[model samples]
Target: MRNLHKIKLLYEKYLNRTATHEEVEELFMLLRDRNQFQHIHNIMEDEWERNDIDFSVENLSWEKVRSEWPTEQKISDVREMPIEKHAIWSLKIRKIVAVAAGVLIAGMMLWWWTKTNTKEYRTGFGETMEIVLSDGSRVLLNANSKMTWNTNWQNIQERTVQLEGEAFFEVSHQRMPVNNSSPDQKDSISLMPFQVITSDLSVNVLGTSFNVASRRQKTDVFLKSGEVLLVAKPPLPRSKNDEKKTAGPSLAKHMDSIYLTPGDHITYSGITRALERHEEKLPDEPTSWVDGFLVYENEKLETVLQELKDIYGKSFIMEDSTMLSRQVDLGLPYEDWYTVSELMSLSLEIEMEENNSEITVKKLEK
Candidate 1:
């Protein structure tokens, strides 16, 4: 309320030709703020009514101005130019100012609304988070991960989200009306595809539970239950014509796509841009990490150490190069990091010394 009063005072001073140069600039800066749209509109409407400006015929409201506003233009560039005192009371001048103010506010509103609607979720190293999206879907974000999505899902055709690092998704089913259907089939509703996009691949699913990890220039997807489709994105085009051709469905259709069933795992290397599939039986409960436990069997020692580093924010150093070839079969709880370290040392038959966040491994003397 106080801000509205101040804006009205500055506007009145501007019209009376009593405002200094700095005051005129301050009034414009305040008017450019999107949050003050309603206040500015109210002030302008009151001014127009007093000046006997006919708005009824034109149906000029803030919404109409906003819809017709140019998006690419900046409102800050619209400054109040100095005019003669004789021109201050001109009815034509008053109407021009009113229209210009509405357009300026609309431009700022478009940019500000977009920024406020997109949401981001992130986790720090050694931290994990569980997010319940607006669509009733659930995401278990692992350590050092980020996910972004548009919160306005009702207006979106596709349920899409971008992921970086690792996360487990349990997507909810959404039945939306099929578009471009025949008149008789207009009432038909179909399952909407939920997409999790990474740098190199897009995982499309219709209500499924799976884990996705994209890090170190590689992407790994492990299906826990339900179906998933992996679509490899096309490489960047070298020319404008190539870019246009790739934008067509023909190019995207030719891109590699693989289907996954439960217990299936696929690894995509960003360097080679090739996918390698593994069909062996996964160790007991591959997603046990989501329950605060790291469970793996016959996994390389180096892989286990890397998982440890991600969870505990620790660095592992192997004094003996042969340790890299060792395999680990273990299930350790997240809360018991020290005990897990001790158990790993005993199982590997190596001397493990920890100093701060670095762990040094040496061959134990027999």
Candidate 2:
């Protein structure tokens, strides 16, 4: 390891204007260490304060730099000087201030780019929203989930979306235009990569239909048709003893990929980042919600009611708690909101009484 003390001495010598060129190079080499960045920043601040540069002028100068940095267009405010010679800034102080301004400008741009480039799709309780993408693909976002994607998606070949809830995706196919310059040219449209990124797994596909559900630190991907490739990214949702800090650049460290044919289901644990795959007999009923029908197959009466609560933003309380557990199978349409509960009650052969926010269900015979 390079001695840090040597770096400090070299910086001091440079500040005193007595350092050799070789010493200056060594000092910069030491500054390349990220750990040294903050140390150097502290030294720069000290030097700025020691030089007694006018506070008002320095602030005005930085404001000018910040506004013009993105355009690379020069402005006169920072470079303007007072008539008095003593008020002029030293070359070393000017250099330090320029570097500081550049660093500040870089940080500001990074933050602005991150905020502006992405757009979010979110649905409230029981709301299912259909979003048409710029690439002609469609996404059916489920209740109480958020999905974020690049707003400038058309310019990028690879399409990726980050998800926090359930969504159904119908990826669009891209066809390359014919090239007439060469008569012998063949069609060469590269398979566009589409990824639905959850906290743990990245579901990659070309042109396919798939469902992703992420809830309670668990991510599930079900392939309804075509194929998918799942890559696991680690430092998953925190767990006891295995927890790592979640705030940092999320660079994908794909250990391996699991390939899935049609009707394959994969679940990834947010804590362990362990993946488990299984073959599923894909059913149309699972995605019937996208077409405005919510189907329940032998699910609990309580579960069915809760799903209703999500869709309609209503409160459901079973007077007979055990009846709530009774297996109920039915398909509820999104239309006829006023009559839905009555229709569901008659269909299930049960008595349902609604009092404002609450829905009560009980045995008809009783």
For this target, which candidate reaches the highest lDDT against the unseen true structure?
1
Model 1, position 184: C-alpha lDDT score: 85
Give the Cα RMSD of candidate 1.
10.5
TM-score of 2: 0.58
Worst 10 residues of 1 by lDDT: 72-81
Across residues 249-335, which tens digit of lDDT does each residue of candidate 2 receive? 335563445666677676788577666655433366556777888777767777677656655767866667788768877878866
Write model 1 residue lDDT over 220-309, tens digit each, in one string.
899988988777775322344334222334336546556677887878875677666665445425578799888877878888888777
lDDT of each: 0.74, 0.68
RMSD, one per candidate, in order: 10.5, 14.7
- Pick by TM-score: which candidate is best? 1
Measured with C-alpha atoms, the lDDT of residue 230 in candidate 1 is 76
